[model samples]
Target: MAEVSAEARIEAPAEKVWAKLTDFSVYGEWNATHTSFPKGPPASLEVGGQFEENMKLMGFPAEVTWTVEDLADTRTLAIRGKGPMGVNVGTRYTLTADGDATTVRVDGEFTGAAVSLMAGKLKDSATAALNESLRKLAGLVT
Candidate 1:
């Protein structure tokens, strides 16, 4: 299994950051890993909602079918998905409001027979991607 996480403090209110985070229409503009959504983002975000996303991981293109596992308005959102090669992945986004600033953290996990073979490299790539995603999110929202 491989896991990765990253955090960033954006100089923007939680509401502002949350708006941009949940707005999938602009995700491609700020999310470095996002490629496209074949059927589009979920109409509503809630536990059990499903969405398909095209992603680029470690320079390799892949598609995932994701299901919302948890959510809390402006506070937390998590999704679990299955990708190619029997890989299972999960990502959790957490938002903590601090006065006018928001602390955003992303936690990711990969588990599957394939993960153990490239755990180190996958961790490095995923960590960088998470950090880059956060930086882009801050740039777009703040």
Candidate 2:
């Protein structure tokens, strides 16, 4: 398995950041891994709700079906997904409000027989993507 995380302190409130995060219609503009949502983003964000996402990871494109596993109004959201080649992926977005600013962290994991074969490279690539995503997100929300 490979794990990667990135954090950013944005000059925006949690509610504003949360809105941009869940606004999937514009996700591809900021999310580094995003390709498209073939079936569109979920109409609502709730535990057990599922969505499909086309993504490019480590330069390979894949379609993943993800289920919302956790939620907390403007604080946290976590999803678990199944991708091609038997890959299991998990992503968690945590937001901490500090006055008018919000600190957000994106943590992700990839696990599968295939992951073990290139864990180091995958980790490096994923880490880069996470940081880039955070930068873009901050730009949009803050």
Candidate 3:
């Protein structure tokens, strides 16, 4: 399995950050790297709720399905998802209050046939994307 983890400190409160993070609909607005996403069957963000999205990964368009596996109000959120590219992605977002700011960490594990071959490249790419997205997300919240 290939994995990547990136973190950033945003000048916002945990609650504020969590509110925005949990609202999956606005992901496109903040996450510049992702393009396509599901349209209908509006999904709720419950522990077991699921959502589907289409996005470009490694220059290829792929469909991904994500299921909420854990939630911790304003602290952490975790999900398990799979993409049409034969990639299984496990993602986790953790928020920690730091004096008047919030430290956000986004980590992911990419597994399966597609990712198993180029483990180093996959990890590097995911880390880059996550870092970029975290910077953008921090800017949005702050």
Candidate 4:
């Protein structure tokens, strides 16, 4: 398994940050790994909601079928997905408000046989992607 995380303090309120985070319509605008949503964003965002996302990770393109595992308005969102080559992917977004600023953290994990073959490289790539995603997200909201 490979795990990665990134955190950033954005000069914006939690509400503003959450709006941009959950707005899948413009997800690609800031999300570094996102290539496109083949069927668009999910109609509703709730536990069990499913969506298909086309993503590029570790320099490879993949289609992942994701299910919303958890959600909390303006606070948290977690999703688990099944990717190619029997890989399992999990991502979580967390937001904490501190007066006028919001601290956002993204956590990700990849597990499967494929991951074992490239754990080190995958961690490096994923960590970079998460940091880039957070930077872009901050630019949009702050």
Task: Indicate which candidate wins on lDDT.
Answer: 4
lDDT minimum window of 10 residues, candidate 2: 21-30
Candidate 1 deviation (Cα RMSD): 0.7
* lDDT by residue (tens digit), candidate 4, 1-142: 9999999999999999999999988899999999998988887799999999999998899999999999999999999999999999999999999999999999999999999999999999999999999999999998
Q: How well is each residue in 31-104 modelled by candidate 2, as lDDT tens digits?
A: 99999899988899999999999999889999999999999999999999999989999999999999999999
C-alpha lDDT (0 to 100) for residue 13 of candidate 4:
99
The pairs that clash in candidate 1 are none
Give lDDT tens digits, candidate 3, residues 1-142.
9888998999999998988786766787666447756664336678988877776656667777889899899998898988876789898999999988899999899889878778887777778888888887887787
- Quickly count the clashes in candidate 1: 0
lDDT of each: 0.94, 0.94, 0.81, 0.96
- Candidate 2 residue pairs in clash (backbone atoms < 3 Å): none
The TM-scores of all predictions, comma-separated, are: 0.98, 0.98, 0.91, 0.98
Q: What is the C-alpha RMSD of each candidate to the true structure, in Å?
A: 0.7, 0.7, 1.6, 0.6
After superposition, the stretches of candidate 1 with alpha carbons farther than 4 Å from their true spots are: none
Candidate 3 lDDT: 0.81
Of 1 and 3, the candidate ahead on lDDT is 1
**Clash count in backbone of candidate 3:** 0
